[model samples]
Target: MSGTEALIEAAKKRAAYAAVDEFIRDGMKVGVGSGSTVVYVVERLVQRKNEEGLNITCIPTSFQSLNLINDGGLNLGDLNRHAPLDVSIDGADECDEKLNLIKGAALTLEKINVFNSKLFVVVADYRKESKVLGQKWKKGVPIEVLPLAWRAVSNYIVEHLHGKPILRMAVAKAGPVVTDNGNFILDVDFGEMADPLKVLTDVNRIPGVLETGLFVDMVEKAFFGTADGGYVTVDRKGERKVFQ
Candidate 1:
């Protein structure tokens, strides 16, 4: 890997390990989020379980996460049966100063996991941090929509919200990218978003929309791994705590 890629990978591991070590407890129900950074979280959790004999049930946000949990040798349970989780640890595509997150992939399931968790912790590398939402990750918001209503939803976002919405195309498949829920994804760009909460509400109000990537006011704490081999925790109250 390149130097920058190596740094990012190190940061991801540092942040993930920190979040797991700080929040996880024995016998608690945990919620695991998806994406690359979260892979480290699961790895650390499995290590703790094996070494310290930590007994915890994990709730996965997607099929990928479920596999990660199983492969990590951690106990897995469905959200429907085990919700109101003690804590949730996941990664973000981008996060603003206030801890508002822009999560990519499995947006709907991640939302449900965060909503059901009492303590929601986000983990990411330094590159994912920004002074404002959409500053770092500019790929736009990933909105999950029903397959049949995707065109209508795209048009509505353009005409009503004055945003550019594009259906996510699959790399392996022939057509649009279908989500795990058998739905479509629309990555909408609204430029620099000043009001993420309002944007999230407006987008979800559109017909056939399942969920948006904008995770507003759901995060309690965010752990950002610095390229310099350290980690910083930003709480909901905007307090910064650094750890090496």
Candidate 2:
């Protein structure tokens, strides 16, 4: 593998280690997040479960994530029954220098992700970077909204939030994209976000908007796979250190 790929592998290895080490206690409940890096963590967790018979419950961030959890042979539970998750391990599209993140592929699971978990862990390759959170992930911020309020939400994104939004179209399918929450999605492009938290708050305040991808101050820690088969750690307090 290339150095960058090697680094990503190492980072994923460490993230899986971190999650398994700290989150998967005996008979504990866990939250599994979406994306590529988190797949490794899920795999590792499954291996541990099978080999050591660690009893734990997992809540998935989306349908796809739910499949991953199931395929890993972990017990599944709904957030309604399992509130206050022990920890959530997911991936990020971008991480600013401050370790702030942007996430949205798993929009259906936002409420569960936030309310069910006490700690959120972000796993990513080092390449997911921008000076600011919104610069790199330019596909626009993923916003989930009530189907009845899609028009209002789109209008608010454009007029109030100064964003350019488009109805998320599923080209492969013949209908508007539907989120796991059974909501419509609006991809809003707000170029060069100055304050992600403020933008998130503003977007969320709009009627009909369910959730935005801009996650601020939510991640407790992040594990980054570097480009040299190494890993780095960043905490919510902005502390960073290279991990051996």
Candidate 3:
């Protein structure tokens, strides 16, 4: 693999380690998030489930994540019944200097992921920048909305919210893109948001907006794999340390 790819692989491994160390507990309910980086966490959890006999239930952020949990031999549960998860493992598109994050893979997967978890852990490679949430990730923010109010939501995002939003189109198909929540998605770009938390609050206040990808203060900790074959962790308190 190339250098960046190797870093990503290493990051995945470290993320798995972090998840196994902190998130996994005997008989605890865990939340699994969608994305490439979270895949390794599921794999590690599965091994622990078999070898260590950890009896943990997992709630998935998406259908794809649900499959990962099931294939890993972890029990699956719906969020409706399993409120207040013990921990959640996820990946971010970019993390700022303060460890705040910008997520969603050109889609609104971040919404349901954040909603179901209590302690959200972000895992990423070193290349995931620590500048500002929007600086590194130029892709528009992902917004999930009610299907009935997509038009109103889109207009609000563009006109009222001061965003440049486009109806997400599916490259694989000929129709509008659909999210795991069975809702339509809008890719919105606000261009270097000065205050992400305020922007997030404003967007959420809209009638049809279910959630936006600008996650502010939701993450409790972050684990980043560096090129030097080591991992670094940043807690919500802004404390930084290296992890083996």
Candidate 4:
């Protein structure tokens, strides 16, 4: 890997470890989110579960996370038992100053985990920090749509929302990337978003658009592992705390 790539990966590990250490505890029902950074979070959870004997049940937000929880030896939980989670720890593609997030997915499934959790915390490397929604993460907002509705949703986003929706293609596969719910994802370029919540509402109004990537006012705290090996946190109060 390139030097910069190595640094970012290390940073992700640091952020993931720190977040899991602070938030998870015995008897807590935690929501495990998706993405590369969350991989480290699961690793730390496994360590704590085995070494410290931490008793916790994990609710996965994605198929990948479900596998991680199962393979890591953490107890798996469903919505019925763990809906009101102590906390949900997730990774952001881009987190703006207000802690709004982008890079969306699994419409109903992820939201099931998100809204049910009491506190939602985000973890990421420095590369994901942004002053606004579209600043750092160039990939447009991901919008999940029903398989049959993909074309119409894409067209609506362009004509009404004034956005370009690109069908996300699979890397190793032949067709479009199918979501866990068997839906299609359209990475819609809304340009630099002015108001994330507004964007979310406007996009959802489009028929067939299940959910927009925009996460507005849902974050309680965000832990960022900086490129220089320092850690910082942005809290709900919009305050930055550096761990020295």
Candidate 5:
């Protein structure tokens, strides 16, 4: 890997290991997040499961993460079977000072997993940390909508909500990206939102909207991994702590 790629990998590993070490326990139910950074979380969880005999059940946020859990030899389960999980560890695209986050994957399932967990923790590299929401991640908020109502929702967002909405197209395919739930996605740019909770509520006001990437009042804590093999921890109460 290139130097930059290696640095990111190391940061991911550091955050992942720390999250797993501090949160996971024997026989507890865990939520594994999606994305590249979460790859390390799964690996670390598997290592702990085997070496320390940590008998934990894993709840994955997506199909990709489900496969990761299986490959890591972790038992897979669902919220129906294991509601109110002991803890959920997920990655974020951007995390503000208050611990609000922007997610990029199947947020419908992710939200369910997070809300059902007793403790929700986000783990990401330092690049994702921001002074406020929407400051760092500029790709816009990802919203899943009914495939038939995508245009209507987009129109509503632009005309009424004062946001720019674009249908998310599949790069490798000839059509739009189809979510696991058979819905379509729209990436909406609101431009430095003053109130993320309000934005989330406004987006949900439109009909046919399945889920939005904005996670408000959900996360309890976050771990931001620095480049030099350390972590900056932040809690919902706005407390900041560092571990090197």
Candidate 6:
């Protein structure tokens, strides 16, 4: 990795490690979210489990994280056995000042992880921080929809919502990216949103939309890793505590 890439990786590790230590406790059910930053999260959780004997059940948010739990040698748990998780730690592509986030993946954003957990926290590196939603992370909002309804949904978004909806194609494969739930993903660019909740409400009214990556007013706390290997904590009230 280049020096800049190494620096960002270290920043992600610090935020992931600190968030794991601060939130996870013995005997608690934890939800593991999927992303590159979450890779470091599972590392710390496994270390704590082996070193401190932290007996905890891991609830995965997606198939990717399911392997993360199992391969990491953590206690694998499902919602059938572990309902009402104590906390869910996730990563965001973009996080605004008010904790409104634009996430990339969503297999269990609404099903169990975000809704079932008592506390929802986000972790990301410095590059994800922004005063507005699409300022830094301009990739747009990811919305998961039924495979057959992608065209209909895109039409609605473009005609009514005035957003550009592009189907997410696989990087290594020829076909479009298929979500773990066997659905299609559309990254809709609505421009810099001033009212994300309004956009979410509007898009949710459309049919065949399974989940949207717009997580508004759902995060309880967020940890943003800075370039200096420190982190910034944002509470629900938009209060920021810088830890250097």
**Which candidate gets the maximum lDDT versus the true structure?**
1
Error (Å) of candidate 2 at residue 215 is: 1.3
What would the per-residue lDDT of candidate 3 be over residues 1-244, giving only the tens digit for each residue? 8987776687668766775677678977787777887788888888888788989888887777889988888899867788778787788888887777777752354455466677788888777756776787777788888889988888877788788888888898998888867888887888877688988889889988887888887888888887776788888898988865
Residue 193 error, candidate 2, Å: 1.6
Give the clashing residue pairs of candidate 1, or none: none
Per-residue lDDT of candidate 6, residues 1-244 (tens digit): 8887787888888888989988899999998898988899999999998899999998888877888889989999877788889999889999888888899886445335888889988899988988889888778899999999999999999999999999999999898998888999999999999899999899999999988998888788898888887888889997988887
- Per-candidate TM-score against the hidden true structure: 0.98, 0.90, 0.90, 0.95, 0.97, 0.96
lDDT of 1 by residue, 1-244 (tens): 9887787789789989988998999999999999998899999999998899999999998998999999988999878889889999999999999899898879899999999999999999888889988787889999999999999999999999988998999998799998889999999988878899889989989989999999999898999988777888999999998877
TM-score of candidate 5 to 2 decimals = 0.97
Sort by lDDT, best first: what order? 1, 5, 6, 4, 2, 3
Name every residue pair that clashes in candidate 6.
none
For model 6, the superposed segments whose C-alpha errors exceed 4 Å read 107-111
Cα RMSD (Å) per model?
A: 0.9, 2.1, 2.2, 1.4, 1.0, 1.3
Provide the lowest-lDDT 10-residue window in model 1.
3-12
Give a tens-digit lDDT track for model 4, residues 129-172. 88888877778999888889999888887888898889999999
Off by over 4 Å in 5: none
> What value does the lDDT take at residue 206 in candidate 4?
80
lDDT of each: 0.91, 0.79, 0.78, 0.85, 0.89, 0.88
Candidate 5 lDDT over 1-244, as tens digits, reads 8887687778778988888888888989998878887898888888888788888889998999999998888999989999989999999999888788899898889998998999999999999998778788889999999999999999999899999999999999899999989999999989887699999999998889999999998988898888877788898898989988
Clashing residue pair totals per candidate (backbone < 3 A): 0, 1, 0, 0, 0, 0
Which parts of model 2 have CA positions greater than 4 angstroms off? Answer: 1-10
Window of ten residues with lowest summed lDDT in model 2: 107-116
